[model samples]
Target: MRKFIVAFFMLAVLVSLVSCEQKESQVVDRKAEMKTSIDSLESVLKAAEGDLDEDLGLQMIDAYVGYAKEFEADTASVIYWYKAGEIAQNIPGKELYAVTYFANIFEDHPNHALAPQSVFLSGVAFDKMGDKERAAVSFEHFLEAYPSHDWAPDAQAMLQMSTDTTDLDTQVKAWLENANKTQE
Candidate 1:
């Protein structure tokens, strides 16, 4: 009975060690894979910079977002999130992706250096998508949390502009009415 107990304990310890090793290996593998993908996409982007291939830009954004999400605790993750958000801004169809990636930096790692910029850019992304309400909310959040930031003025202006579209709306309405008058 004593010998059996000793063998069982040894087996358990060995299994635990092996499990930890496997977990570490998996982490390294995942990081390496993301790095490869990001590098490949960036290389393609550099080669086609002037023409601006929106599709490749989106792929690069996805790679950066994937890396950040998969390794949230790593410092590099926040940087990748910023990169993803910035790239998404230029891609016409990826405004929402930009907003989420930008929000993730501040929402998940508020103490990081990119947090303030991320919040500001989140508002910009929302604005670009024509989501005035959301853009105003994001700007408000930035002002509340980062009142002393250099971009505070910009955020405040954006908040006001988003909330008050009366002039533009009135002009559009008047234009439509005039068109109807002309048609009649």
Candidate 2:
């Protein structure tokens, strides 16, 4: 019984090592495959002249999102996530995907170089989608977290605009007061 237990433990250890190796190999293989597909899509986009191709663009977004999600430990994942968010933001009706991808970078990789910009862009994406409340929240979070970032001013502006929603009203009030001042 003791011998059998020892042999089983040894086999289990070997299997665990083999599985880890296989998992690492799988990640590398998948990354290579994804890189090839992204390169192809980029070439197609570059050749598209002035017109944007939605289908090809979505494919590239999917590839980038897949790579980023599957390999979040990889630093390239943050960059690809940002790229995916940018592409999704430009594609009508995919704004939510843009917010998610951008959020992924800031939330999952907060210390990464792109995190601040990604968070700010997430706010922009939400604003573009007309979800002003969520956009304000995102912007506020970005500003609070990255007060010294270069994009902080942009984020602050967006946060104010999104939170206030009364620029036109205020402008009209000023214009009406200015016109009435002529009567006085």
Candidate 3:
């Protein structure tokens, strides 16, 4: 009985140690992946800024978008998108362009690796553009739609803190009335 108890305890400790090691390995792998993504994103962003040809610009954007999709959940996603957005701002006639691009990642790829965070950054771009109302709406939508997401708390805080000067009451009332009628 004593030997059996010792064996069981050893097994349990081994399992616990393995679990912790696996978690640490996962964190290290994620960090390495994020570093690679950042390096790739920085090059593309730099090229996009220096090259004026439409095709080159589009290609750079596409490359950045692809990497952004892959590393969207990685710690490097925010920084990558911010740099991409900065480059995009130089493109003329591209009003709220970054918001639209990032929003599409959330809209079209809701189950994607970076969807929740893409939505959060989408709200951020809107807010940066001085469209606080839409930013709040986007953040609220992120919270309601992705309540279980890793970024939900951040979305909720953003919504609670957002101050919209626009008369959102009218739109909210209209939406509620339509929703109620649909239920009936």
Candidate 4:
């Protein structure tokens, strides 16, 4: 009876170990699946490089943003989020998504080379969306963070324009022209 009881306990222990291993395997499978999805999305983005149809680009951006949100700590997440923000800013009715994605980049990877650009673009996205208050805030944040960046003058102009009450399109055009001049 003692030997039988010991055998039963040993079997239970083995089963528990097997179950734990299976759970670990399941986690690994999930991570692999996520990586595959991210890679596939990146490939799609790459394939669309020259064509860049707005609808398809928006779809890709949405997919990338979804994956970025799911894998926030991954390097791919930062790249995907930045790409999504760039695409979002150009698409009509998607400026807020651009703002969100750019803000995410700035918040998650503040030391990255793209962080200042993200902040500036977030302001542009807000301005494009007609949210002057938020646009001003984002522009101010960018200037405070990168006072001497090449984009600083543009950010300052945007901050001033945000409170100008002028036609947004006209202001944006003037700012772009001024920015181009500065770059020249």
Candidate 5:
């Protein structure tokens, strides 16, 4: 009876070990599946960059919008948004879209190293949209918040330009002309 009892105990221990291992394997499989999904999404976004289809590009951009929150505290995503802002601003009627990207980096990731640049780009996008008052406000906020930042000088210059002229319409016209020259 003693020998039989010892065998039973040993069998129980072996079964428990197997069960633990199976659970570990299941967890690893889940992790791999999640990684695969993220990678697939990234690949689709990258490929969409060169796609001539606006619908596909916009779809990818919308998909990336979901990942924007995931990018919180991630400096790389800040840079990515900054670049996306640059691209979106260049496309006519997309300035507001670009504003959203820049605002994400500036507001959600304020302490990020790229936050100042992100704010500056936000102002630039606003300016491109002919919203001088809002642009001035954005630039002014960046200057006051990050006075020592590398982009501070540019922001300050933009702020001065934004305020120097009394006529809003004239400033708007000049800004558009300058923007056209850059686009060309």
Candidate 6:
């Protein structure tokens, strides 16, 4: 009876050790995959810095979109979604997808540091896509959710500006340009 009990104890210990090792391995693998995705994205962004061809830009945007979906639970998803939104802005008539990407960051990771910016950008994306109603809604949601955020004032302004009938795109573009400059 004693030998049998000892054998069972040893098997349980072995199983526990194996389980721990497997979990550790999974974490390492996930980290490695995230690093690879980030590196690839950096490469694509660098290639896009000078003389970016439309075809290549589209391909890169597609990749970033895929990364955003695949890494949704990962914090790096915020970066992937943000990059996807920025890249999608260059593509004609694809502004809605950028809005979706920005919305994903805010919806899935509301506590993330980038969530407030994502909310504001989603409003801009909707405005650029010519959906004033949705843009207003997004801006309102941003204000409600992040009233103390630095972008709250801008969000309020955007909500009001989205009501205008003339040159909305120009206004939004100017606001985004100014925001970018301020960030720099």
lDDT of each: 0.88, 0.87, 0.68, 0.85, 0.75, 0.80
Please report the candidate that would top lDDT against the real structure. 1
Worst 10 residues of 3 by lDDT: 86-95
Measured with C-alpha atoms, the lDDT of residue 84 in candidate 1 is 87
Q: Indicate whether candidate 3 or candidate 4 has the larger lDDT.
A: 4
TM-score, each model?
0.80, 0.76, 0.44, 0.69, 0.57, 0.67
Ranking by lDDT: 1, 2, 4, 6, 5, 3
lDDT of 3 by residue, 24-68 (tens): 898778667666755665576476775555555555555556666
Clashes of each: 0, 0, 0, 0, 0, 0
Name the TM-score of candidate 1. Answer: 0.80
Q: How many residue pairs clash in model 3?
A: 0
> Best-fitting candidate, measured by TM-score?
1
Worst 10 residues of 6 by lDDT: 48-57
Tell me which residue pairs clash in candidate 5: none
lDDT of 5 by residue, 40-134 (tens): 65576577774434554454455455444553444445665765676677677889988888888877878887788878888888888888888
Task: List pairs with backbone clashes in candidate 1.
Answer: none
Q: For residues 5-117, write the lDDT of model 1, one tens digit per residue.
A: 99999999999999999999999998998999888888777777645577777778878888887887888888998998898887897889888888888988887889999
Better of 2 and 3 by lDDT: 2
**43-125 per-residue lDDT for model 2 (tens digits):** 88888863567887788898898888787778788889899898899999999999888888888889989899888888898
Worst 10 residues of 1 by lDDT: 44-53
Question: What lDDT score goes with residue 33 in model 4?
Answer: 82
Instruction: State the local distance difference test value for candidate 3.
Output: 0.68
State the lDDT at 45 in candidate 1: 71
Question: Which segments of model 6 are wrong by more than 4 Å?
Answer: 50-73, 147-149, 166-184
